[model samples]
Target: MNLIAVYTTLIVVLLIWIGARRNPLMALVEIGREMLRSYKFILIIVGMFSVLALNKYELQIERKMHLAADYTSFVFGLEGHFVRHVQELFYAPWLTPVIVFFYIFMLQSVLAASLGIYLLDKNRVLLYATCYTIILTYAIAIPFYLYFPVNEVWSYVPAGVKFTMLEVFPRFEQEYRPLSGLNNCFPSLHTAISVSMALLAFRSGNRRWMVISGISAVVIVFGIFYLGIHWLTDMLGGTLLAVVSTTVAVKLAKLTLRSGEDRLRVRSRATHTR
Candidate 1:
């Protein structure tokens, strides 16, 4: 199989394994049923996918614009050799693959499975909140990616961090670089998304999902540094973004669902009168 196929299959398997804990087979069926039944649910799913598409388009725009600007120096100036020290302090040949696995696969896997698990639990509020968090996170981060560019820590020689991701996924640049730009390193989306998912999982009240997402977030955050991909400032900014996105998304989701409920009640009353 090709790289994308392999990644997708693995992610699907992981999602099933997690979702299976709570009748996720029914949840899978329910996702379809709900989408067909509720325009609001369908719209939320569309909005989620639309933001992802926008993210891809934004990458293309960034490339065509050729924003040769590099803020790596500013990041390095703020935090000198932090990533290098972290790597040097904990560099292990055996640990590389484990970290790379989480970096490459676990982030996206947990994200996808979170949606499925939410559906399985029948928690529409958290599901909508998760989708909204994703939309908001990308919406805010894309601007920085376009305007304020920062290279990866390893790419910046002054940082003295080695790109450990290369150790395992040597063809990462050739395979994955198309999806992720080399210079899009200001606020680590991996950090933000993983952390935001974990925050939402905690709110989901699913003990299993909470543990899974929490571990995924912590490991991914550490992996970014261990893999020599993101700087300290990037992680800090990402954490802040996660907080803002999650808070706003939760409120927005509640309001949107409440409004939908009110409209449904009004329609019911109208039907009864008729």
Candidate 2:
């Protein structure tokens, strides 16, 4: 058995046990019922995934567009060199673990939010909101990635600054890029999604989850910069995109809920008349 798989299973089991302390089986049954009732939620997720997968293939179309190297360079100007120095100051063997862990955690926020908020807290609305925000981040970021190819700071290494984060996790970096796809650095989807996760977590009533996701978001914002993966302007763009995406997602969710309620009310009235 894979140790990580076994460990994850045990943790989930423990949570289920506690969540349904009086009757674990009944708790699972109730969860099943809820899932059946919320089947549309699953469809929503499927739709989002479909869009992301399409985005990957669509990136080939992006190559025809000109690189915004001059524009991206103008974005940082002298500040890029200054931040590079700041990044170097923190580069050490000791800091590698936290940086790498947080970097991965930032990417995994969607999974964490789904499990943490939906399963642990049992709030589907918050869960969907969190998920949609991440989805929307990708939706909005894709166009920029297609047209505005801002090279990752690391690409500028020998000229301006060293690529600090990748240096620390060279093997992991080498392995991750094939799957992650390079040349999509503008607006930092990592930053946007992490921020959205933090926002959703905080809005959720669960203070513990909020604190954890909030901390993760802050670390990721700093981490991307420290790692030399994003320009400071990219962080700003990501943040703004997050806010817009979350706002739109929440509105659309409310509209969907309202539409469902209206349909249900009409059916109930018709049945009673019958």
Q: Write model 1 residue lDDT over 188-244, tens digit each, in one string.
A: 999999999999877766666778889989999999999999999999999999999
Model 1: lDDT equals 0.83
For TM-score, the strongest prediction is 1
Which regions in candidate 1 have their CA more than 4 angstroms from the true location? 1-4, 259-274
Q: How many Å off is the CA of 91 in candidate 2?
A: 3.0
* Colliding residue pairs in candidate 1: none
Q: Please give, for residues 7-26, the per-residue lDDT of candidate 2 as tens digits.
A: 54454454334332333344
TM-scores for all candidates: the values are 0.90, 0.76
TM-score, cand. 1 vs. native: 0.90
The 0-to-1 C-alpha lDDT of every candidate, in the order given, reads 0.83, 0.62
